[model samples]
Target: MLTRTFLHFPQVGERRERALWRFGFCDWHAIVRSVAPSPWRHLWDEWQREAEASLEAYEVGNAAYFAMRLPKSAWWRAIPDFVHRAVFLDVETDGTHRITVLGIADSEGYRAFVRGQDNFDEARERLESAKMLVTYGGSHFDLPVLRANFPDWQLPPLHLDLCPLLRRLGLRGGLKAVERQVGLSRSPQTDGLNGWDAVHLWWRYVDGGDERALQTLLCYNREDVMPLPTLLALAYERLWAQTLKASQQTFLPMMGSKERRTG
Candidate 1:
């Protein structure tokens, strides 16, 4: 199941010094000089002071952050609990420049609606109500597209990002490659199309009114949603196993110190 954890990174502000130590230059100063070609030295002090204050607030627990955690054992259970509240989202855009359509699928079913379609409002309402959002590369693309298209819409927190997680674990390639590595199979209808193709296909139908084109686009969209549950299960399994291993290693060090002291 999709689970979320809020974490406070109190020391993230200290990263500025670390960055300067490693790079031999302050990030803001370097960026400003490179972009403007004019002296931005006066702005540096004010910027650094503001950044330090922001970091202090974060350390003091004034900043909030969230991450999705999925446990491996949860996947093998009779029921996948995470899917109950998770929404699998895929958007079909006219081009990389703009979002044209948003296709959302959940346990209930699927819906494909254009950004300005009559039913787009209803679909957006449903998205806002979901408990968790599951996607492959949403943090970089899908989430931004959704935010841009529906400026007022607020999505549930992301529960899992299969693509980056897989990459982090040294799994290579894109979603399809990960599927193969994990032994997840797909139908021919879906096998032939990738997300970019799906976006193009949907744009064709939405802009041209070709029923056949729409059918293929819907099939592709449905395919995108179908694999999400499996991907989520895999990610949960891997992350949970790693977490357990790390906990054991940490405990061992503490236990060893205690035993030495007692001896």
Candidate 2:
């Protein structure tokens, strides 16, 4: 999708990029390698330099460049081919202001980050280094809560908040509801848990020292994050199928269930 994107450069609006496309200047590499024609030749050298710099920035894992280059709508397509640098995020909080637990998954696997029981620094490190973030409702819930929790923390450059995207496909309501529509059924142990149940689990753990409650809470939290990548991938395919150009559209495999669960 990044290769198909022509939005990174200055002086190249949709109309101008269409001109380039007609002249066979289809992609960044094509533009850089071809000799520019008369009218645009004077600016070509500078554009080439910026293009190389942008590609280099991506190669070096410099996500800030992308933050500046891409519009939010294009973020989904711009996700890199390799997803190891991406993280799936979800949080379970007390009904009020406290975050009871968070589950984050990356290429390595998913784990629950429980308050007091674990260090946040490790989760913070993975979140900071991730290039993309996949979440069900992180934009409205998790992200704002996290920002309030840690004012200085920075999220990854690209975020695909699936709640709205799925809504685009007429899949409405909550995460569990969306999962059912998409055939991502939860396991029996965690199937019926909700945010309120999560709060109960936390209170039982903290007030009564019920270890079972904590484990169940973690299971619930883990379940919240585990299906994000697949859901996000499906959202991408369903929503983009109508809009993506023929040259840009291709079947992208969902991340392996093994990597998603274990990683």
Candidate 3:
């Protein structure tokens, strides 16, 4: 999908991309092979160069170049080895702009960056290094809070928000609630907890400097992100099925927990 996305090129938007599709330019390769030679051909030439470079980077197991064009897109399914390039992100805040804890998990491990307790730069570095970022509701909540929290540094180039895709699949609820439908659940300590509980836990740590409370907060936050890979894969499979809805096959197997595992 990333390879077929033309919106990454300059002067192209959703409308322009659709126009390209109508003009018989359906994929990146199609645009590159087009011989119409319009005035916008220069842009396509430049994009061809970048697109080839991105694919090459992905082929070499290096996401460095492709990561630069990371934005919300349906193209991820086409990008090879995308699971390893992704980092799932979630943040706990005070219902406003104050972020008390920022959690991100990838193949490396689950990481929690607490305010005043750990180095914020560490989390920033980890996120910046990731090629893609996945979030459940980051479009409205997590990403805004993170940007406000770190005005200087930029997040990963691409962000995949699961909220819309989940809604399309009839999975409508909070993160934990949606997880429940899919047999994903939190541990005993974090079970039945809500956002308010997280706030109280943070307050407990801030007031008494209780590391236990802090640890619990981290654990709660970790649950928010741990199941993202499976969720993302499930979303992709569903969306792909929709594209082939005309087919007689009515069911697509969901990605297994083992497949979602980073290790």
Candidate 4:
């Protein structure tokens, strides 16, 4: 028996069109002109208007609605706080470079879904809902696959490339390497399969319909989501503790001089 993932369809509304537009499924100008005759045309017009406003805001180097927009004084503090709710994302693709599945995890739990599953849709929806997204090496690879696969789906969320952040904190290497460096252990079930193998396994399952292959693929995907929280926690510890210590050291010199003057 195949284990299928489930997804719920959000109620049909204006946001769906906005999602489509955001991901570039259709041009706002073209859509607005084409839909002008329909009664629901107003909905499309409103969506396009809002999209234009959003683009205008971004053009001026402001991302006010995005999670990265924080007051300068609060920006550093916000990174750690926001990461707590972030969904760490990863993807597996076929040898031909087509994405076969996606994995995401947060405080709630981890989820992995094949391309056509309702669970895939649910995962996409959750991604759309997040205030921040955390991923290692997702900026160039994982994200492009997602946008390509779900052209009508809005982007997952405001992305935080944990790869750079991890580097900044002196942790070196890929996701698995970082896991090992930070002392996060993996379960025995995930022993043999790495991400590339996981993608091939999915292709085997999809093309050959081998149940054992599918099981292996799912297990690998589950493993991918499992370590993300630990990695995120480690990042938080390193950034927050280091930043706080630096702040104190910066202030310490002023304190000594003030004490000498008072004495």
Top-TM-score structure, candidate number = 2
Scored by lDDT, the top model is 2
Q: Which digits, one per residue and each the tens of the lDDT, describe model 3 over residues 1-263?
A: 44445666667776676566556665556655666458566676676765566556655655445445544455444323456767899999865789999898976888888787789988888887776788998999999888898988767666778887788889999888899898887899989988899998888888898889888888989888888888888887777566435222322233332322211
Reference-based lDDT, each prediction: 0.55, 0.75, 0.72, 0.57
lDDT of 1 by residue, 1-263 (tens): 11111111122232333333244333333433343223334445554554444334324322112222213222221123324556888776767747765677775777777555547877777776665677778878888887787788877643456677777677878777777888877787667677678667766777787768767776776676678776766665666456436433222121112221100
Separate clash counts for every candidate:
3, 4, 6, 3
Each model's TM-score, in the order given? 0.60, 0.82, 0.72, 0.62
| C-alpha RMSD of each candidate structure in angstroms | 13.8, 4.4, 5.8, 17.9
> Where does candidate 3 stray beyond 4 Å?
4-81, 246-263
Local error of candidate 3 at residue 156 (angstroms)? 0.9
Deviation in angstroms for 102 in model 4? 1.4
- Model 2 residue 177 lDDT score: 96
Backbone collision tally, model 4? 3
lDDT of 3: 0.72
Rank by TM-score, highest first. 2, 3, 4, 1
**Candidate 2 lDDT over residue span 31-113, tens digit each:** 67878798789889877887787667756666667667877766665544435678999988888767889789998899888
The residue-level lDDT of candidate 4 at 69 comes to 33
Residue 120 shift from truth in candidate 1, angstroms? 1.5
Worst 10 residues of 4 by lDDT: 1-10
